[model samples]
Target: MTLAQRTPAEEAPAGASYPDLRWFPPGTHITVRGLKKAFDGNPVYVGFDIDLPKGKIVSVFGPNGCGKSTFINMVAGLLPIDAGQILFEGKTIAETRIGYVFQNYREALFPWLRAIDNIHYPLRLMGIGKAERERRIEELVAGFDLKFDLHRYPYQMSGGQQQTVSIMRSLVIEPEVLFLDEPFSALDYEMTLIMRDQLQKVLVARGVTTVLVSHDLEEAVYLADKVLMLTRRPSRIADYMDVDLPRPRDPSTLTDPRFIDLKARTLEVFQNAVRAS
Candidate 1:
């Protein structure tokens, strides 16, 4: 269905309405209300409410051990929500095409497949032909700056290299929504910044709706358009702060007062969650 078919929330901005949600494509207009989850009777989250708009980058933040990863997994359909509904583009989770990049590079990439083959795996599953798959893979490898060791196995590549391949594999099929669970945590400080900048460009260019979970406060504020701060587990959103600064943002923009204000606000919410926990 087109964006025009969607019924807009009463508070949506002017010239922006449902059935015409072009501003937030790929991403779901998620209304997460009363969400709760438990494993073996241990509750991780409860009574959460969040509105994740389309095409926007949302950073899910909380103190360590908060249900940030669990929340992301539930949204990605890797884990089932014990209670509450996850709506994607006004549809159920089953209707969305999600790409998940796990926290660990070792787990996300395959040791058995070559880089190109791994990148092509999803496209092949989607029934894309050989020529198209090669074209897509070439584009991804170049865009992400994959090494010439394309035919080498994951074990042969460095940590950063494996991560680049893993990320490329996830993006090959152009998922409707992308979940990045600390995709840069494994990289060294310098590599992290480089990858962060590159990933931001790629996500914006592809118009992919992205939800990122990261412990790096600066990274969250830098990469996300909105920050969703969660209370410690059983996790719940304490505050949602929008980063009103301009887009195609440079890392240098992090030094600006507006960006600093947003970061400070986000940290305050995090501190509140910690104390409340």
Candidate 2:
């Protein structure tokens, strides 16, 4: 239970603790105990327990509608947990500083606002001063190597640019935990690769605990320190794979024997879940 405070871009007070996660040990930033959820008498999750580690990326993958998004949404408080608890130490979900990047970038963006404004929107809501907001957004843009102009409206940008804006919006707050729901699903293969690298870079620099939902096997392994594979109805974590690939990953990483083996093993887990269902 000794995580260091996650300071923001040159602005957090000297020696201030980031209360969002500093109290928890590295391996249990968010603990879900006996979690359960259902809709109309049908269960999605039952008696599920998992520990989301501090400052590490955990990717969740499973068959469609197997409650991956539902799980994270419950954790994020977008929806209520039917039972059990999701907690950061003793804090409620809302007490934590959380950043969420939804799967649909276009829908999430403010059409009338410039990309920069959209990214700055959340900070403004939190009452962050203009100068401090600029510093944080600037850090995110520079860290991600975003080259696109942010003055344009969301409708004027391409899918990738819009998503990049969405990502920056999530990161501007320097959240203690970040939730990404199929963040790259809208991009093409090349753009997906580019976005993945950008995400990894910022994550490394920020050291935020992250939970990602990805459908792509390669992507799950590429971005995660560990992959949580889910089962069908009455959803549960069917298996877990710790990805040990070297950092600063590239296309070449996909070819490494280690990466290949990890993907194959994860794919097998999903395949078995399918058969069992």
Candidate 1 residue lDDT tens string, 1-277: 3234444555567676355443333444665656889878988977666778787789988899988888898888888888876777667777877788877989877778887688888888899999999988877766665445888888888877777777788888888888999888878988888788878888887878889999899999999888888887787768888877887888788799988988888888888889985
Q: Candidate 2: misplaced stretches above 4 Å?
A: 1-26
* lDDT computed for candidate 2: 0.87
Q: lDDT at 77 for candidate 2?
A: 87
TM-score for each of the candidates: 0.86, 0.89
Per-model C-alpha lDDT, please?
0.81, 0.87
Error of 2 at 146 (Å): 1.5
The best candidate by TM-score is 2
For model 2, name the residue pairs that clash: 1-25
lDDT of 2 by residue, 1-277 (tens): 2112433324567666555533334567888877889999999987888888889999999998898899888988899887887887558888998999999998999999999999889999999999998988877777878677999999999999999889888888888889999999988999999899989988978999999999888899999998999999889888987887889788899899999888998989999998887
Off by over 4 Å in 1: 1-28, 145-148
